[model samples]
Target: MFKIVKKWREQGTIERARGTGLENKKTTNNEDATLIQHLRAHPFTTATAAAQITNFPASRRTAQRRIRQISDFRCRVAAIKPFLTQQNKENRMGYAMQYLIFDQNFWENVIFTDEKVFQSSRNGKIRDFVLDSMKHILNKTIAVVDFPLMCGPGLVVGVPDCVGELMVD
Candidate 1:
């Protein structure tokens, strides 16, 4: 309004006032660069540990804020995965290569089955009721005509002409 008009009349441009905060004096470019370098060296280091440096000594909160300002880095839990050795990789590759040579009919004949054992503890005795129940259910559903070929602990027997509707008990 009137103040704007008066200011505009006095000064050619209507820009806001500058240099009115402690944000600039908090940390310099050099300090930020040093902190970034330290973070790069030790990525898993906590803000509290990083703040203990002689050159860029600050509180944990301040250190975190500074780090955030530098990059889009955030803390996260590491995911667990199965450890595979060289032999494991080679074996996996060989298995895949063997399948590549075979036709689609080869896979149709293969009956893939997986079983998980659920352990339950009651009083002093460990009752494996879940595993027994699962096995019973599978046996009832799958009707074996000829001699069933057992692959592993949980069998993957190939039953010919018995791939109809499964009878669940």
Candidate 2:
């Protein structure tokens, strides 16, 4: 039964297989933090179970090494306590109160406002930074940022030197 479980661990059916050290292998794109988080919450029954969590082919020895790596980081346990503390849940209203303390009229006089946004149709600010979305969307999407160049005289009203601003949160 042990050997059979070990074989399953090696095959990747079980990601957290103990003794394989496969999970220790540095991933280029790290697994979601939730994976590590799950392990902390539940100790697995078999090496096969450990192997299953890793999503990598792992043998008993590989699983052991990976478990060691995970264990080594357990020192971070102290930090998690504070991070998850109810104190963290305390009201963040100090900032909100301070904001209220300020005169609203002063802000109205300044004429600046902040906002958040998503993909745009006639409205603005998109940077694919991944691709030049401008040519594709053109006036239709408003992606490549400063396009429709809000600067030229043809534009009307309180717009700035740059194109329409896209507020993001």
- Candidate lDDT scores, in order, read 0.50, 0.36
User: Candidate 1: deviation at residue 24, Å?
Assistant: 2.9
Compared to the true structure, candidate 2 yields what TM-score? 0.22
Writing each residue's lDDT as its tens digit, candidate 2 over 58-132 gives 465555455445543221111111232344323333323344455866445333222223343322322221111
**RMSD of each candidate?**
21.3, 19.5
Residue 44, model 1: Cα distance from true site in angstroms: 1.6
Question: For candidate 1, what is the lDDT?
Answer: 0.50
State the displacement of the C-alpha of residue 27, model 1, in Å, after optimal TM-score superposition: 1.4
- Model 1 lDDT at residue 111: 63
Per-residue lDDT of candidate 1, residues 1-169 (tens digit): 8877888999966666676453455777777777767655554445555567626756677777877777655543323335657786566555545555778886677665444333222222221111212323233234311112244223234555544422111
Query: Model 2, 32: alpha-carbon shift in Å?
Result: 9.9
